[model samples]
Target chain A: MVEEKEQIRIGIAEGAILATPGTLMTAGLGSCVGLVIYDDSRLLAGMVHIMLPESPHGRPSHPQKYADTGIAWLYETLMEHGASHAHLRAKYAGGSQMFQALQMEALRIGERNVRAVSMQLERLRIPVLGADVGGNVGRTVWFELPSRHYLIRTARGDERQM
Target chain B: MRRLQVDPVTLDALREFGNIGAGHAATALSTLLGGRVKMSVTDARLCPFSEIVDVVGGGETIVAAVFIRIFGTISGNMFVLMSLPSADRLLERLLERLLPAPRKAQEYTELEQSAIAEVGNILSGAYVAAISDLCGISLNQSIPAVAIDMAAALLDIGLMMSGDEENQAILISTSLVHDGNNIDAYFFLLPDLDGTEVLLDILRGKIRHG
Candidate 1:
C-alpha cells in the first residue's frame, strides 16, 4: 500500500480517496453531498459521495450511495483506522439545484441530504469544522491527508478551504 | 396515470434536444480534457416513476449517479447510470487520469465527486438551458450535485410514487451515444401531466409565436 503511487478518479455512481499520506484526492459533487471525514491523529480520511439524503423506509440499496448510510460507513471505516470522536472532523460540500423543473419536496434532494448529513454528524458529535453546502453550484472537494484540510472547488472555478 | 409520453414526435424532439445539449457538454468536456471526446445522444423512454425499480435496478442495485435539483416548482432529478463497466469508463474519460479500480469500491474522493459533478453540471446545464430556450420557458438552474449507488437511490421512485393517481411521476428515459459504453440519462419529469402539457404548449408557442 505504501508504494501505491497513483491518482484515482471517482465517476458517477462512485467515490474514491487516499487517506494514507499521499494517496488521496477526488471531486465533482452536486445535489449529492460530499462528506470528507478524517482523523488527523491517525492520518486517515475518507470521502463519501452520496446521492439521496435518507434510506428508503423499507429497504436501502447501495449503502454507499446515500448520506445516512455512507456517513455511517465513513465513520466506522475512519474509526477502524484509529479515529476518535474528538479527532474526528467532517466537512461537507455540494448540494445544488441543477435541474430547473422540480419544486417543493420533489426538488429538494440537495437540501434534504445536507440536512440529513448535518443531523448524523450532530448525533455523532464529530464536530464539523466547515461546510460549503446547499447551493446551485456543482463542487469538487479534495481531502488532503497530513494537512487534513478539505479543499473545495466549485464548478465555476471557486476554490476555498471548507 | 398519464406519465411522460415519449411519442415519436416528442421522442425525436427530446432526442434532438439531448443531442444538442450533450454536444454542448462535449464541447465543454473537450476543453477541460484537451481531447475531443464526445458523448453521443441516444433514444428516449417514458416511465411511470413506479417502474423505476426495474429500470434502474436489477438483481444487484446498479450504481446510479444522480444530480438532484429543483427548477421553479418542478422536481428535476438528473440521473446517470450503468453497470460497473459503464461507470468506470465515464469516470476515466472525465478524469483524464489513471484511476485505479479498487476491486472493492467504497467512496468517491472529493475531486472525483466534483469532477463528476462537473460532468453533470455541464450536461444538465446545457440540457435545461436547451429545454428552456426551445420551450421558451425560464429556468433557474441550481448547482450540480452527485451521488453514486444502487439504481433505487439514484431514481428514488418511492417518493415519486407515494401518492395516489394524482401526484404520480413521469420519467423520461433518454440515452446518449458514445463509443466505449452506453450511458442512460433519465429526465424524470414531474408527474403532473398538466404541467408537461403546459410546457409543451410553451414550446409550441415558441415556434408558433416566434
Candidate 2:
C-alpha cells in the first residue's frame, strides 16, 4: 500500500504549518494576505491567512485574523516545529484593490493588509523571497513543502510560481 | 475576536428591513428583464464571519459578484452573487433586451459585463432606496463593481468594507430562482457592527416616536 501526500486546508483568519511530504493550501484570498513562510533546511512551511492589518477595537479573539498577531503566531509555530528562525524565508499574495470603482482609502484594505504583513515579517528579520500581489483580482495560494515553492492563481485563470 | 451577538429584537428589525428591500430589488430586477422575477428572503440573521465561506459553498465556488459600498448615517456592503451558470442565464435574459436572439452559452463578453453591472446597479439601488425610505435616513452608495471569481474571494471584498474588529455580519440573504430553480442567485446585505447598532437604535427611536 502506498500513502498519498496529505493536503491541509487553511481557511480565512487561520494559520497552519506543515513539514515535508505534505502540502499547505488556502483559497480565495482577497483584500487579505496569504503569508507563507518556509525554512528550507528544516523542510518546514507555514501559512497564515490574515484578514486585517490590525485589531484596533480591542483584544483580538482569533490570532490569525490580524496580520501582526497572525504572522507572529505563524513564526512561533514554525519554530516550535523544529524550523530554524535563521533559515526562515517568506512569500505572500493578495491585497488586491478588488473594488476598483471605489476610490476611497478605506476600500484599499488589500494594500493595507500586504503592508502590514510585510512590516511584521521585517520585524522578525524574515526576508520576503517573492510576492504576487495588488491589482483588481483575487487569488488562491498553495505552498508545496517538498520544493518549497509558492503557487498563486488569479481569478482570471492565470497561475504563477514564486 | 469576541463575536458580537445581536439581540433578537435587532435581528427581527433587520429581517423586516431586508424583506422590504428584497421586494424592491426583485421588482427592479423584473423590470430590467421584462420577466417575472421571484426573490425570496430565505433566512436573515447575524452570522459569524468565519462561517460565511461555508454558507456560500466554500472558497472555490465560482461566482459572479457585484458589490456596492454604502456610506452615510450607516456604512456597510451590499452584494449580489450567483453561480456562473446562474449568471449566464441572467445575463442572457438581460442582453436579450438589447440584442435579438442572444446566445445562451458562451463566455461573458465586455458588453455582457457592462449589462450585468447595470442590472446589479438598478437592483442594489432599489434595495438601498427601500431601506432609506423605511429608516428615514440618507444612504450613499458607490458605483457597482463586478467580478467573476470564487465566492469566498468575492465575499472577502465585502468583509473588508466592514470595520476590522467586526466579528459578526448581519447577513440578510435573498435567493432568486428561475424556471423551477434552473438559475439560483444570492443577495447579501452586510452592515458593520457599529452600523448595525446605529441602525437598530434609529429603528427603536422611530418606534418610540411613532
Candidate 3:
C-alpha cells in the first residue's frame, strides 16, 4: 500500500519547498506569478507566489513577494536543500492581465512581473523549461515533485500540463 | 502614507461609509431595473488580502465581476460581483428574455457583458458619488471592465493596484437583492493604504468638528 504524500498550499505572496513525493500548489494567481524551481534528478523543488516585479527598497521584509528577490530566495533555498545548481530548471504560470480594457501603466504589473521573474531566473542561470503566462485570465498552478508534473488550470476551465 | 490601524470608532465610521454608499447604489440599481432593489452592508472591515475572496465565498467561486479603478483625490479598486446564477438572472431582467439554463461553464455574450459593465458603472458611480459628497473630495472612475471567473482571480487586481506593502485592505462589502427575484450581488470597496489614511483623516476631521 502506498501512503499519500503531503499537499502544501502556498498562499498569495508566500512559497514552499518540497522534496520527493509531495505537491506544492498555489491558487488564484491573477497578476501574481507562481514559480517552481526544481532539481528533477533529486526530486527537490521550491515554489513561490511572487506578487510584484521588484521590491520598493533594496531589501524587502517579505522577500517572496517580489519577483527579483523571490526568485533568488527560492534558488538559494533550493541549493541549500541539497539541490544541485547545475540541474536546476524552472516552470511558471500566471501573471495575467485580468482586465484587458485597462491600458494604464500600473495595470501592466502582470507583464512586469513576468519580465522580472525571467530576468532573475536568467541571472541565476536557471533555464526555464516551461511557462504558461500572459493573458486576461487567472491560473492555479501545482508542482508535483518526483514526477515533475507541473499543471496549470485557468479560470476559463482549461487545464494543461506545463 | 501610514498603514491604517482600525480602532472601534474607525470601524464604525467605515461601516457607515459603506452604508451610505450602498444606499445610493441600491437606489441607482432600483432606478435602472425599475424595481425595488434592497441592499445591505454585510461586512465592512479591514480584511487581509488572502481572506478577501473568502468574504464573498471562496477563491474558487465562479463569479461575474465588473471592475473599475477609482482615481483622483484617492485611488482604489471597486468590484461588483455576482454568482453565475445571479448574473444570469440579472441579465435576463435587463434583456427582457429568458436565458438558457445555466451551463456548466457559462459564457456571457458581448451585449450581456456590456449590460453587466453598465450596471457596475452606475452602481460604483453612485457609491463613489455618495462618498465624495460626504468627504467633499473629487473622485473619478475609469471605464468599467467585466470578467466571469473565479472570485480570487478577479479580486487580486484590487491588491495588485494597492501595491505589495499592504497585506490588508479596507473592504466594504454590500449585498444587493432584487425584489421578487433571486438576484443577489456583492459590491467590494478596496482602498489602498494611502487612500485609507486620507479617507480616515477626512472622516476623523468631520467627527471632531461635529
iRMS (Å) per candidate: 10.1, 3.7, 1.8
Pick the lDDT winner: 3
> Number of the top candidate by DockQ?
3
Better of 2 and 3 by lDDT: 3
Model 1 chain B weakest lDDT span, ten residues long: B157-166
Model 3 root mean square deviation, Cα atoms: 2.3
RMSD of each: 13.3, 3.8, 2.3
Instruction: In candidate 3, list every pair of residues with a backbone clash.
Output: none
TM-score of each: 0.49, 0.84, 0.92
Give per-residue CA lDDT, model 1, range A126-156, as digits (tens). 8888888876555666666677777876544
The CAPRI classification for model 3 reads as medium
- Encode model 1's per-residue lDDT on B1-210: one tens digit a residue: 445444566555655566666667667766765655556655444454435556655312535354545456443445444444555666676666656764222345767766666766766677677776677566666666565544433443233323222333334444444444455555444423255555554544554455
- Tell me, by TM-score, which candidate is best: 3
- Compose the digit string of candidate 2's lDDT tens values, residues A5-69: 87989987888888757889999887888999999787788888988898764556678889988
Interface RMSD of 3: 1.8
Residue by residue across B106-208, what tens digits does model 2's lDDT show? 2457677677678678767876886786688888988888776667877886675565545566566667754444455555667765766666677655544
True contacts kept of 1: 0.02
lDDT of 3 by residue, A90-123 (tens): 9999888887777888788889999999999888
